[model samples]
Target: MRLRRLFLLLLCGLRAEIQEQDVRAMVGSDVRLGCTYPEGGSFDLNDLFVYWQIPVPGKPNTNSVVTYHLPENSSAGHSDSHYRDRAWLSPDRMRQGDFSLQLRNVTPQDEQKFNCLVFRKSLELKKILEVVVTLHVAANYSMPVVSGPSQDEELTFTCKSVNGYPRPNVYWINKTDNSLLDEALQNSTVSLNARGLYDVVSVLRVRRSPSVNVGCCIENVLLHQNLTSGQPEMFAGDKRSVTDGPAHDTLEAGNKPVFSVLGVLVVAVAVAAGWLCRHRCPHRSHAELV
Candidate 1:
């Protein structure tokens, strides 16, 4: 039984099959799909032809990304319009068994399977090799920017993250309590740009608390990466004084001059009453007169 299973496994290995590879690429960046010939076997360019293929959505036919004919020593045809002028093969390394494809200015739509095939023909025999790579594209968004205004007893904060793909999750944090802001206090929106990337914004409104620090956080759930804005503080109450004066002047204004005048008048009246009593008394004890 073991021998039969081993033979089946070996036979399957010899047949053409899909080999998947996961690749992460940022939007507007370049990426390379590496495809090399079978190990321990090499073929001369004179007898080889290589091509790359990708599937088109809602279509039965596969799109030709690029192709090279060794006999002609040139590209056999132009790539699809979407990939034209942006896809190419490494001719310098072709003879060394490397059939890698380089793609430039990639976008979200470029996330798909890339297939590479090589056919070698000789006078007595023909051989074929196939490789398939699955690419996973991702976009990195800019740092979150938080802004807003405080009015009366309410404070509002807005958070924005731009140019990211696959949609991002955005929320607010109250650093004073080490907790995420309640959903009831926040609202968020997302929009796709012309390039198919996402622009996310969130707004948070709550009663003003000057002691708490509020911040915005943006996350790429697919990539498991996150970015947060710097801590922003809130302020409460009407800090402005009535008079347009310096801080010290405002402090001095709180003191009333009428109170100071009244204090002096009370002391003078007490002295006058004591002097009249000393002069008006008809009889007095010796100690008292002295």
Candidate 2:
């Protein structure tokens, strides 16, 4: 009976060990790390102490530490200088079996194994939570370029730019007044060939006139309100003068009056012929005997 009792006690201890809590989490996002004792165990929040430490790679070692105690609801200790202001214990949710620690504005440097330890009246338990955080920082912005024929001629303008992190906001701007233009011309058709990367073409019809200046601007919506303009290009038609070409010939323009006069005379002759034929053969039927 003594041997049987000892075996039962050993089995019970093994079961308790298996029931202890564990921790797990992902990177660049929020995570919770804490411990829980078996139900009816002589343990409370005050009896447990929790902390996180980054362990050496493939070895049992640690260089940084963060410790927290309950009720006071504040960090009790920190071995790493970097985590001093960024790591803290969450007071509001810790008492309800939430040994979860809250780390804000997490950086890649904080990624590692975290040790959560619980102690009460000579009974002690420890769980290790592993953390992996990825670092992501967006690069610089690039201005869009506008290309094609000069503005004075009936021409198409194409705007293009590269895709960047945080997805930039791109649009066209009139350089003269610094005002925003319709994504494309109002009467023109606008096609967004690709998102992030884009090409938009706008056609403008201009009469014989002098060169005019225009600009195409691209902007980052989240970072700035001002726009970056493309190099100024003059309209080609604006460079021409009246004396540089032959005199404006209305006849060559297809507006000659002779065509209209001929059309009117033909209509008048047709009407007169119909009137004479009707009078001379009044009441005559083609099929009647002579």
Candidate 3:
């Protein structure tokens, strides 16, 4: 009987030693908070109440806000108003040693130290979790400069962007009517010329009525800020002229007076040729020939 009692004592001591809790996180634009507790503990989660609280900065020993709580089935408990829709408990997977808390639409206000409180029967145990969320804001992206010849000429545009975190996607925005024209003029090319920098060159064959406006937009997926520019500076070959607008002159419709003068000259020449043929003809009538 004494040996059995000693075995029971050893088992209880081992269980107590194994009851461990800790919090870990992966830091970045989106931060994750993790919580883990040893299994085979004396506490029953169903009989226990769980709560999360964040302490106010500069206010030591004072809890600023209650973020979340798991109320008893019979109690008409309520979640903190601020975290009503933002906080959620881990699923069954978490009960099996997975203590991950998913917070959606994370903001700067949510960055703080958090604590997880566990209450079972009349015993209370608490664990602290540190959460640090970094905000990544992308700067504005610049528009491209289109250059080259006018109608029936080769054209090129260079897209540029600056001050973007976590890199930016660069591409040419195209606008064409026909499918063939779209395929021929489409500039889906992209390249990262430098760190956090990008450039794309869009090239196409210029046709009649050659002027066109192209847009370059830089979008930040995390912040959802879009910056777009369509006014591209025109250039003639590798050199940029001091000219104040499109390199080519706008052509007007209809024929000029020069075309009319050329037509009149051709008519006058035809009449003179007919008169010369008549004068060269001899008097070769049928009676004269006999």
Candidate 4:
């Protein structure tokens, strides 16, 4: 009987080793880290304690995010100042064995590994359970802004997107034809802002060509979404091609012919209206009226 009880106890302890979990959160949103006791044991709320923490970069010590103690029936003062007002645990649900932490107003800095620990105590007995969760924060990027293909011999244009997380990528696309551009034509740079969001810019330099339609695209790999500015369909170049490549000058050149055709049609419509009125209206003889 003693050996059997020891074997069951060992199995229970092994079960408490919580499996790692992955969490993805968006910037400026709230996130929840889930932790709960495994089956085979009831959680005693009278002497329960829960703690959530994250590893400090380049330091041996971990940073305290939040903590809850049921014995005191209070849970506000135990967290680090950085997460004092932002982290929360539900006392009511905790009574039912839920010890999740809800983190509010998440930012890029919140992307890290979070450790959850639960402690329970009874007369002459104590137990602890741990769970490690990896959190990834994503921020959507704005549409890439493409500016300038200077009318000089060598056209130069710049593309930029701000306030993105995990470092978004920017590249030049041939709007004239839906295809990737040559790597030589694009130069990209990424920088982080004070808030930890990424700022990206790309410069494109190519020889001046009237048939080339170009645009810039920004993509967030985490979200699997991309946005492009100055689409090729807005230009009048090649209708059959998927990508467009041209500057405003070429677009205007394409527009002049279309406008000229419209001008001629308007003049013909005015002449026809005048001719119809003259022939269809009833005319009184000038001699009889006099």
Candidate 5:
């Protein structure tokens, strides 16, 4: 009866060893999938083996990710062709019940369900631990760049962001009132780049106003990141000149006319001086000759 009870307890322990974990990692970064064997406190190093695999597309059997035994010394392990040197298990960590898999330079394809099984090589390789890990990878979108308040009938502007993962939400805002613009006034496009990242562009059109303050925003929901292109303020019909005040709002619109006036004054002074010298000097010379 005691032997039967111990066998049942071991079975229960094995069942309890299976754990499910979710991990999020950024693209081109290294991440560790947790597969710790907490109850495995007294195991022989020479008799231990660990295997990590991901599900194959069409096969019922899981595809190998990495395998570990001896000679790793916490550094190396045999990995599948797809994983190659980018995935490995540490022998030194395994002895301490840390059989986690380290994946390097994570890509979009690395996002998958992984299975880790640890076995003790006694009579016939007995399974001692198991873990399932789901990896979620994310990449933040680039900062938004807004261009133009070009006028044809309505003022038009374009905003773009590149190399983001999944999709992103775009927003156009009126900075003067800090209010969201009408969605019907804007058009957006999203495309996958060569690296499988998202590229987005949005064009917004608004009616011409006396003073326009507009901004663009992009949000990556997966990464919990938000980027904004600051509001640009332009005056359409303000007649204030720079000479009116130093801090007037007309600096942009008033500087060009100021430059033109200075150019005209320079040409007028040159012509006046030339005409006076030409007419007066010839008359004085002719009088001296006479």
Candidate 6:
């Protein structure tokens, strides 16, 4: 009978935790880390204690996110400097057994495993629950910008995007036929910036031809989205082709006509309006806007 009583006491003293969970958050957004307790309630505020912490690699001490001693509801004195004003808990929700955390403006650096521990006081503080939450962070890349051959250059185009998370794929498309250009004819590179974001650059070269229309695409697998920008339909041949290149340049410049043609059209419109005004209003003086 004494052995059975000892077994009961051991079992009663041992506590178990729920399985770990995963959460996905986007960069520059807010997220809630879920945690709860059956008895982290207001019934006995003096007995409840909640703590949120993150384990740092190669460090003996963990980083404190927030700590609440139910009796006082005070933040941990030694909270990590990086998380200051960004991580917080709600006292009103704690009154209803909710000890979740609210994290604001989550960045790529915020990706980590968080530990939530709850303690109940009796003769002393006794751990009652532990929850682990893993956070995965992601961000969308900016729209691609494409630059093509200059007036005196060959048919080389560049496409670039910035402020993306993770590396992304790059492709060159012949917008004339909607077909992807050969990968061998393109060079692509991706690099990480100081802010932990990615920047992508790609260059594509096309053969000398009479006309060419090309597009550059950036594919972010993490965000499952793509951005594309097409060239303004530039020329592809030698100096002799330069004679006709300005036509394409004109089209790219918002379909602006040549100066001579624009001047002639303006003169014709002014003459027509003057004639109409003199004939319609016979008593008016013979004066035109031109």
Instruction: Tell me each candidate's TM-score.
Output: 0.66, 0.32, 0.33, 0.71, 0.67, 0.66
Summarize candidate 4's per-residue lDDT along 40-73 as a digit string, tens digits: 3445566775667787688866354455554566
Which tens-of-lDDT digit does each residue in 206-274 have in candidate 3? 343444544434444443444433334443335332222212221223322232346666676456433
TM-score of 3: 0.33
Clashing pairs in 2: 151-235, 152-235, 209-238, 210-238, 211-238
Candidate 6 lDDT for residue 66? 47
> Model 4 compared with the native: what TM-score?
0.71
User: At residue 77, what lDDT does model 5 achieve?
Assistant: 56
lDDT of 5 by residue, 1-290 (tens): 83344233333344435789999999899999998887757556777656687877788753654555532234455656778878887666777888899889988778889888776657355677889999988887765666666746678777878887767888776656556677788999999888778888899888866566666667776666666664333434532221111111123542433334476666764564334223311111111000
Highest-scoring model, lDDT? 5
**Per-model root-mean-square deviation over C-alphas:** 24.5, 25.7, 24.9, 18.2, 20.3, 16.4
The residue-by-residue lDDT of candidate 1 on 1-290, one tens digit each, is 83344223323433455456677788888999888765635557767656677887788653545544444565544457777787788765667788888889988888888877666546322335677878778887776666543465567767777888778877676645445666677899999998889988788777755344666667776666666665433333333222211111011212432334466666764564334223322212211000
Clashes of 5: 0
lDDT of 1 at 157: 69
Q: Model 6, range 103-206, lDDT digits (tens) per residue?
A: 89998887888877666656354566677889888887775666656544346666777888767777777656556777778899899888888888887766
Which one wins by lDDT: 3 or 4? 4
Cand. 2 Cα-lDDT: 0.39
Summing lDDT over every window of 10 consecutive residues in candidate 2, give the lowest-scoring window: 241-250
Residue 167 deviation, candidate 4, in Å? 0.6
Ordered from best to worst TM-score, the candidate numbers read: 4, 5, 1, 6, 3, 2
lDDT of 5 at 114: 89
Q: TM-score: which candidate is best?
A: 4
Question: 83, model 6: CA deviation in Å?
Answer: 0.3
